[model samples]
Target: MPDSKYAAYQPAAPYFDLVRRALGDRVDGAHFFDLVTDETVYEVLYDVPGWPRVITGRDALMAAFRGYVGAIALESADRLVVHVADGGAVIVIEYEVRGTILASGVRYANRFCSIITIGNRKIVHWRDYMDSLAAWAALTAPRGV
Candidate 1:
């Protein structure tokens, strides 16, 4: 449950709910607009065709996710497992996200593993890996095929 002070920013349906669980206490002063500070680094391990491997700051992160959010309407986000290490500073999460492609109306589901590091109750580093081939297939399949 989210604290009363940050309740308004609680991850609601259709957007960012996975991010909510991923943020934890950092969500206190965090919003999509002001997500990262100067030192923040967001990295994606797989070689996604049009996306970069490393992203820095709120603006860069926003830009990186813009295309993805616009392309898919998320239906559900479930955390399959979570491991906390380094005295709660490092978190590794295994999760699944289900959604539909906005343009093709095709079903899309993919599993993800993400490692996040929090400092001063804020996310400082995020590294994510996903089934890229699954994503490619979903995006490329003929509509209603």
Candidate 2:
């Protein structure tokens, strides 16, 4: 369980685990939300229903994550490939997540590539790319396991 202060970020746990491993000792944050700047901008390159294409501010991101958890419960996040550039100011991470749709028991899987820009040891900007078709298939899966 996430601390009450970051309760809204519970959905990020799986992904954060991968990030923490990749960024080992590069950033200081016990939780995923803590690694983001208050004014952080998060952008999604692909359109996934129930998800915004662009999100600004860690608070806004928190709300978005809340909605995400309600729709899907992640089982695992892995396959991390990290690339550092510009003396650690910019990093690219590719990963995959597996989960189950809440409304149905349908399994969900998708891969992601995120380009992150850091400032003052916090994530200031994020541009994300994901397998939208795979997500849509899971979202539209037949109800009931």
Candidate 3:
């Protein structure tokens, strides 16, 4: 059965399903741009080891994602659990990123808790939280020989 908490929200389930489907393996960075509304705003708040509070808009967000993708040869997410509140939703997901950095093979895994707010069937706000130390180590650590 579907989550009962989302029963009161008319568009949350469909919107969430759409986002999940759009993020599958065949999709790329451009797909996210298409899924999001032109006026959509995504705010990512993270306090990494060396970085302070980072707040970015749509364009900057896109660029950041692109850079990460460029650094990884392949990336996929699984173990997605969705929770729907009366007026909001949250998705807990785990992701594995595999690729070579400067010709050195490396693989990094991370878990994320994403909070999403919907308005008019579109995501009005998105805030993601993850362990920055794990990410930093993955991006900088030496790969297997």
List TM-scores for all candidates, in order: 0.80, 0.92, 0.60
Predicted structure with the largest TM-score when compared to the true one: 2
Candidate 2 per-residue lDDT over residues 1-145, each given as its tens digit: 4457866556657877787777777787877778887789999999887889989998898888899888888888998999999999999999999988989989999999999988888888999998889999999989864
Tens-digit lDDT track of model 3 for 7-93:
332222333444555344322332344445556566556655333344345565555555444454443345566666654433333
Over 4 Å off, model 3: 1-19, 22-30, 47-57, 87-103
Two-way lDDT contest, 1 vs 3, winner? 1
TM-score of 2: 0.92
For candidate 2, what is the total of clashing residue pairs?
A: 0
The C-alpha RMSD in Å for every predicted model, in order, reads 4.3, 1.6, 10.4
Q: Against the unseen true structure, what C-alpha lDDT does each candidate score?
A: 0.72, 0.85, 0.49
lDDT of 1 by residue, 1-145 (tens): 2345434323233335566656566444535344456778999998866789998886677666676666777788886687889988888888888888778989888898989888876678989999999889888888953
Tell me the spans in candidate 1 whose CA falls farther than 4 Å from its real position.
1-15, 30-35
Q: Which parts of model 2 are misplaced by more than 4 Å?
A: 1-4, 7-11
For model 2, the run of ten residues with the poorest summed lDDT: 1-10
